[model samples]
Target: MKQKNKKNASLAKLTQQLLAIDDSLTGCMRCGLCQAVCPVYGVTLKEADVSRGKIALLENMAYEMLKDADGLSERLDRCLLCGSCQTNCPSGVNTIEIFLHARQLLAEYKGLSGVKKIIFRFILPHPKLMSFFVAVAGRLQRFFRRKANKNMGMFEFPLLRPFAGKRHFQPLAAKTFSAKYGKINTSAAKSGIKIAFFPGCVPDKLFVRVAEASLKVFEKHDVGVFMPDTMVCCGIPNLVSGDYTSFKRLVKINLDLLSQAEFDYLVSPCATCVSSIKENWFRFRKDFTDGERLQIEKIHDKTVDITEFLVDVLNVDFTQSANAGCTRRVTYHDSCHLKKTLGIFAQPRKILKNLSGLEFVEMPEADRCCGSGGSFTLTQHALANKIGQRKRNNAVSVKPDIVAAACPACMLQLMDMLSQNGDNVEVKHVVELYAEQLTVNS
Candidate 1:
């Protein structure tokens, strides 16, 4: 590999790597169809705002039309990388890969912020230290947060306003799931299949009860579960931020933890974790040694989103008579990782449909990005909130008693959006609903 030129990195080389985007880009045909589906482009009509425009920009970079590396990076980071454009693209260009690689290159050049370096590098790697901080944060949340909007779950932190901005957020959990439930080994139920559960950081830390609900569901099905005492972050947060090195470390840690276990499938309530393990690991697995690579492939092969596992793997059935006088109308929001990345839009809905007393209503644009792109929300909050408002509107339009999603990060975002909007819609994990349906007698 040539030394990456601090001043004049070859745009041609960068473009060549980008163009080799798994033939997904080959299908794009420079179609402008993505422009209609892009939320950022919807907000900004700049040619660089749409996927076609960005693809053109990258192509121009290959031919040397776009210079100013910083400017190009800014344009690249503008994307939510929601895969909305790829899903909508007539050519089916792998815009997600292009933007992610582009961001990595730019971050390598421009360098990450000191805060990011500290957070991703130091904190995220060590779940124990991270849990401690979250514990304190949860205890002190009331002192720091002032009601920003009564209905939207919006809160303002006067001290951290400069960094966090005026937006609402859920308070961190006092105890992370990993801390509370160190390791679990449950016997298979009548189904006679075992799975290892990976709840990722957000669900484990912020929404601990969701993980509990998952355990409950597994017990109900008589499905066994294996959870290692120590699991690392899922690495999507590190990967998307252009820190492949840290991402690799996290992947290795997770693989090492679960590699010693015996389970039929690796499961997660988090769509991002399932996709990251199933997809991104393979995409970057080449960097590892043969031994590690084999382990990576094995995990990837076994990985399944929780809903997919419930509906597909265990053959859980959701079609049943609705509970008489069931009053709660629940709606499902498809996390982009589940719907777009893994093509798992229906199974979650199917699981939601099974809840006896719950009315499963479909929201408009049920598959749109909720703008909780992990660190994307933290860094580009204004843009994130703008995208989230659209999601909030769709959910609100349905007037759901509660909102359900496969990803905890999406639940966090939905909770904030609904809270800020002053709507009282509770955000619940799909597994939680399934757990509730388990016949205690069975």
Candidate 2:
């Protein structure tokens, strides 16, 4: 009887907290503009899958008209949180913020699952331990995964199919980027600019070559690089999972490590990490101590996507005519966070266009979300694959020899979509293509 009473009290407290965001919830115009752009709604064709539907549910719950928080959470989880709806909303509803906060509130009310608790709290916050596990998985992957496509670096894991579901994925690196090159601190040369490099978790572990390419670009531009061994995951995974405790802890860890280094800007090859540092970090500034908040603000100001850093800050010229000597055609995919959140669609295209041997072709709907919303691909696998197939169809429609994206997560999705179809197109980062040109010139 006492336990039941305590549970009801906790539920009542959660209801009160939900009411706090009522003003933001009321901002949704319900004009259904989000339906035009929402990738999940496009796939599911369900009202609850769109932002407006979710907002309506939130409003009802806040007003005590709805008692099924779990059902509402399921509806919220169906979204990609790609910020597409928010970007296109007529009323400028803070869709992402409201969804994220609602998720956090619901998570608190229901408590995190054991698996998520382990991943967000224990594994992610500890870089070395996470690295050790990935390294082990890398060695054992060959035993479980058979080569699906050699050129695309894809493998089919029959053992993981129950969980992963016909997913073809890249193998983990034998050595992460940080393990290979520990803690670099170089002075600025001809460019007279210094930057702290944040090779996001995916690039560091799954796509070391991309991380290497970023370094080569930095060196070619004469920009100083500072990469500390201490930096871990950028906390987006935690934040999106509604594990605010883990998210704040990860942020503090990164801020403390980054504060030790002096640089003109903090640059990352991952669009999500750049967005998290710039936009998401500031969203919760009030929760931090005064000094921590100041640090967060400074870091937020300094953070830039590597493509943006190159073209905007370094002023690298990409205007040269395409060489007739080489004829590899490349198409660019605009990542949602890169384009919608950061407004960095053009800089990557400019970099692609300037490459000596590659011809830059624009893919149809290049700015569409590739459906790899970080963990969204994992939880909502079927919906993610459906949305990814649309992106795949758009890429192939351009008939390019290679498809490139500024974000590593997009590259992973593109690789999967193209490889599954046995398409002959190569997937690469914009920097990798640019780095090849630098090598040719050097």
Candidate 3:
């Protein structure tokens, strides 16, 4: 009986923390505008699947009218955290912030699972250990995976299908980007700009070519780089999972590493990483010490997407004469975070347009969510595929030889969708396309 009272008291405390965001919750007019843009709600069409419905649930939960915390957690989990609904919201309610805060509170109320606890707490914070595991997995992957599509570089793991689902994914790289180039520190040359390059987990571990291509572009333009050997996951996965303890640890690890580098700007090929550093890191500023908060603020101000850096900062002249003989049609997919979160749709397209051998074609609904909302793809694979198919169809309709994105996560999703449909279209990062032009011109 005493234990029961203690548990109730704990629940009450969590509920109060959730209620603290009442201003943001009450800002929702319940107009259902989010349904139009929400990818999950678009597929499920369930009121509980959209932001307004979720907001209503949160409101009810705060008022003690909705007692099913498990049900509320499940409903919240359905979200992609794509920022689509928040972007399109009429009331300007901070939906993502509210949902994330609510998730954090709920996760505190009901502790994280064992598997999640292991991955988030134990593995992610240690870059060396994560790399070691990935390296081992890379060596043994052939035993488990069979080629699904040669054209898209996708594989099927029949044995792991029950756990990983019927999906074709890219194989782990033989060597990670960090393994290939342990650490890089170059002096700024002709461009007179130096950037701390953050090749995020997917790019570092899986799409190593994207990271390499970014380096090529940097070298060609003489933009010096400062990539420490210490970078880890950007903590979006942890934070979005409502594991603040792990999130803070990862952030601090990165903060300490980044603070040691001297650079004019911090750049990354991964849009999600850029968004997380630029926007998401500031959300928990109060949790850090005064000095750490200042570092966070400085880092936040300096972080820029690679495309944004190339086009806006470096001001690369894409106006050079186009190679009329070599025209490979390329369409751009605006990553949700790159566009909706960072307003970075135009920069990538501008870079794509300027690439000498590529003809930039705009696909239908170029800014639609690819449904690869970090861990959202893992938890809700079927729903993610449904949302991704729309994006795939739009790209196919444009009939481009290649589809370019500014995000590694989006590239993974695009590769899966294009490969699953047996489409031969190549998926490349915007920087990869730019780097190809740089190679050709040289």
Candidate 4:
């Protein structure tokens, strides 16, 4: 009888948590404005794939439809979490927060899958352990990976086909960024500014050149950098997977590291990393102690995108250079997180336009998502490719020499789309293009 009472109490707690989204979900007028912009709904054409339909599902479940918890979790996973729907919604509904909170509640009630449990819990929080695994995989990958596209630097492996499903991926670096350069806490050289450089996992591991290019720009501007080896994942992946425990652990780890360092700013070349640190960190700030909350607030205040930091803080300029009119046609893609979530749409474009010789062409729907919502690509590859096709079409329509974006994830999706279509147009980070014009030291 006592055990039965305990079980009922647990159920009651889970139900209460699941219903927490009721208030936010109520803001939805069910006018279906979200249907017009939702990437998943665009491809699937199913109501459940759209935000309003999902909200209705959640609302119904709150009232009585509790047996379909698993079904609800699957429907929620269908979303790209691109914030496109929220950006287009007239009601000003906070879809990102609502969906993320809903996912957390669902995970708590239905429990996270076994594989995600191992990854979010054991694999992601420990940087060194994860790095060790990546190092081993990097060493062994060459044996399995065969070149898929020479232009894009993409690879495929027959043996890994079942898991990756013929996906073309950028190979991991022989040596990670941290392995090449140990802790960097230097005094400012030219700009008299100091920063904590948080090179998120993608740039640190797969796209080292992006981080290197960012460093060149920093060196040119005389900025001091503080990149400790102690930094872990930005905790976005953990939150995306609904593993709050791991996310909080990673946040505390980063907070402890940030507190130890003294810098006027925190910068990342990756847009997702910047947005996650500035916005999502603040979103869940209540999870920390008073002291940690203060630390988080400081980190949030200091963090900025690399382009935003360069042009705004250091006063980067190119008009005075010899190659002020240097001639290359380029179009820019506004990474959804940077442009929509953070409202950082203009700064990157301004940097591109001001490039000495680069002509900045505008792509159609410049702010539309490229559909690379982290794990969404891995889970829903076909749909991702379809969305990429649309974005790729818009990019090539301008006939630019290069398609440049601020986010490496966008670059990855662009590479896949362009490579699959056999288009010769190059995909690169905007910072990479800007770095090419900077004077590098011998």
Residues 1-442 of candidate 4: C-alpha lDDT, one tens digit per residue: 9999999998897767766777788788889989988888888899988989888887866543376877777778888889988998999999999888887777776688888888888887777887888899999999988888887778877786665566778888888888788788888876778999998889988899999998887787788988988689898888987778889998888888877778999999999999999999999999799998998898888899988887777776655543355577889998999988888877888888877677889999888888788988887777787888899999999998889899988888888888777777877887887888764313
For candidate 3, which ten residues in a row score worst on lDDT? 60-69
lDDT of 2 by residue, 1-442 (tens): 9999999998787767677767788777679999999999999899988988888777776543247766767777898889999999989899999889888887886788899999999999899999899889988888889888877879999987766677789889999999889899999998889999999999999999999999999998899999998689989988987899999999999988988879999999999899998998899988999999999898889999988988888887676645545599889999999999999998988888777888788988999999998878878888989999999999999899999998999899889989888887899998898888888878
Better of 1 and 2 by TM-score: 2
lDDT of each: 0.79, 0.88, 0.88, 0.84
Over 4 Å off, model 4: 1-9, 62-65, 321-326, 440-442
Model 4's TM-score against the true structure: 0.94
Q: What is candidate 2's CA lDDT for residue 150?
A: 79
Report per-prediction Cα RMSD to one decimal: 3.3, 2.4, 2.2, 2.1
Tens-digit lDDT string for candidate 3 (64-151): 3247767777778999888998898878988899989988887886788899999999999888898999999999999998999998
By lDDT, highest first, what's the ranking?
Answer: 2, 3, 4, 1
List candidate 2 segments past 4 Å from native. Answer: 1-16, 62-66, 324-326
Number of backbone-clashing residue pairs for each candidate, in the order shown: 15, 0, 0, 3
Q: Which ten residues in a row are the worst by lDDT in model 1?
A: 58-67
